[model samples]
Target: MNNKKIMIYGAYGYTGELIAREAVARGLRPILAGRNSKKLQPLAEELGLPAMAVELGASETLERTLRDMDVVIHCAGPFSTTAEPMMRACIEAGTHYQDITGEMEVYRSAHAMHKEARDAGVVLCPGTGFDVIPTDCLAAALHKAIPTATHLTLGFDSDSGLSPGTAKTSIESLGVGGAIRRQGKIEIVGHGELTRTIDFGRGDKFAVAIPWGDVATAYYSTEIPNIEVYIPMSPRRAKKMQRMNRFRWLLGKPWVQNWLKGKVDQKVRGPSEEKRSEQKTWVWGEIRNDRRGERRIGRVVTANGYDVTVHGSLAVAEFLLDYGGDGGYFTPSKLCGYELVEKLPGSGSIKVGID
Candidate 1:
């Protein structure tokens, strides 16, 4: 059992609770923490874990609490608000930091602080969740499979239900428009502006080009010149969703956003125990070496998106505990090589299907 004290901020949330449960099962003592002491108390007692109350916005209090911990796993969503301050506290305290943030802006901000983390000797790694781990890790594997590959395309299909946090984040990114890298530059593409039909073997599903954090990470991780990510959504709903997203400019109005939020809250429900049990996720990647006139494809499949997120977080925590230095900010793709991520225990749960 590792004696390092792990603190899981936002432990009362769905994903946070999953991480806390996994941490305990792995023989790690994780302190349940969040802005609400009242909620944390019950979870702490239920898990036989201690509770620490700290608000992400409260820098002084957060910093003090983080100082005594070896690592902090942040599971809060809409990371745009929480990632920065939490990162600052971790860097100042010289403690390892990790989060499940899928927001591109949040990742960029954390990446910017890499120098500070390196200087402080603390490990700062974000996106240790379902958002990019499975996809990013698979991208690394595909690149290795074809050393000369210069361009890559990746896609995911999952039966796992969406959580409220995920829905909110999607709504936030609406109207912001999807972005993709083209000819060595980031280009903004309207929702549904770029669409393709993907056959996942389950059936043919329509996928739209969407902005994802992988665009940045893959460009930096591999030699790929251009990369694109697609997520499958029903065609009938795609256009409607796209239209709403395009008008998301109107959501800037408080009343419109609030009304939309209420509607989404009612319609977008999180996974239930039964649904989570039946859920599975699959990912596919294609790598091409235009210079050499060759193409290679790779694929991976796994069960339970939330379970994968928990496993990914544990992988990061173990890496931080064993190999990470005193203080430094890093993305998972940067801290460890792609091979290391592929070799992770649950990684093999992914099965490859290619032509």
Candidate 2:
């Protein structure tokens, strides 16, 4: 393990707590950090870890505080607002950075920072969560099988509720038009532009294209030119999404977004501990070369999606410690490959192979 001290920034959030617990279990002593020292104090005490209370907007102070830490597992979400400062601070502090974001904009911005990260000699990686770990690696594996692949399609279904952080992020993404990779470039597409019934080894389920992070990361990892990502949705919710696209302008309104955010605040907190243990996350991916009519499919079913995020993020952070390479932006598979998924605890419960 990299022996450098680890800091779990936003460690008071739902996902941050999970990462902190797992980090401690792995015999790591992480410094829990977030905006609320009072909250961080109790959690850090319970875990026997130190705590730091630093707001993301405090750049100089944030950089100074992070100077002693070797890497930071950033957990605060709605990453459009939270990610950039932390990333900048990490680069300035020469501390490696990782986060569990599935936001395409954030992924694209991070990818664009590759040169800066390399110059700073610090690895900058995002989507260490369930977002791209299984999907990105599946794309990488398929690309390895068919190196000439020209197009890719990915789908996922999770029998779990969204965390508060995820809910907020989802709301933030609602107004943005859908995205797909076309000719190796990110392109805007109408919501529900591509819908398909994918047989994920269990049964046929309806999936609709949504701007998933894989649209960005898979291309970086596999070089597949055309890509579409789908998520399982019921008929009503699917139709609602499509219909609302016509009124998407309303979603971006400050007042409208604020109202929705208020409602989200009223909702129950993230999944219960019981639900986290019982739910399963199923992901399906396929790559193909239309010219050659060649194709490959892969499936992964892991413990709970949230649990996988916690473990997967920690695994990536730990791996970066011992990694000896010029630091730059990377997808999970590009950095570590399928071996990461294979080694993660509870990932043994995951199933991945050709269809």
Each model's total of backbone clashes: 9, 0
Q: Give per-residue lDDT, candidate 1, residue 61.
A: 82
Q: In candidate 2, which residue ranges exceed 4 Å CA deviation?
A: 1-3, 348-354
Error of 1 at 301 (Å): 0.7
Q: Which candidate is the best by TM-score?
A: 2
In model 2, what are the clashing residue pairs, if there are any? none
| lDDT of candidate 2 at residue 67, scale 0 to 100 | 91
Instruction: Please provide TM-scores, in order, for all candidate models, with all chains considered together.
Output: 0.91, 0.95
**Which tens-of-lDDT digit does each residue in 226-337 have in candidate 1?**
8888889878777876786658677656676567668876888667657766776767777887887777666666656777778888878877777734466565766766
Quote the lDDT for 56 in model 2: 90
RMSD of 2: 1.7
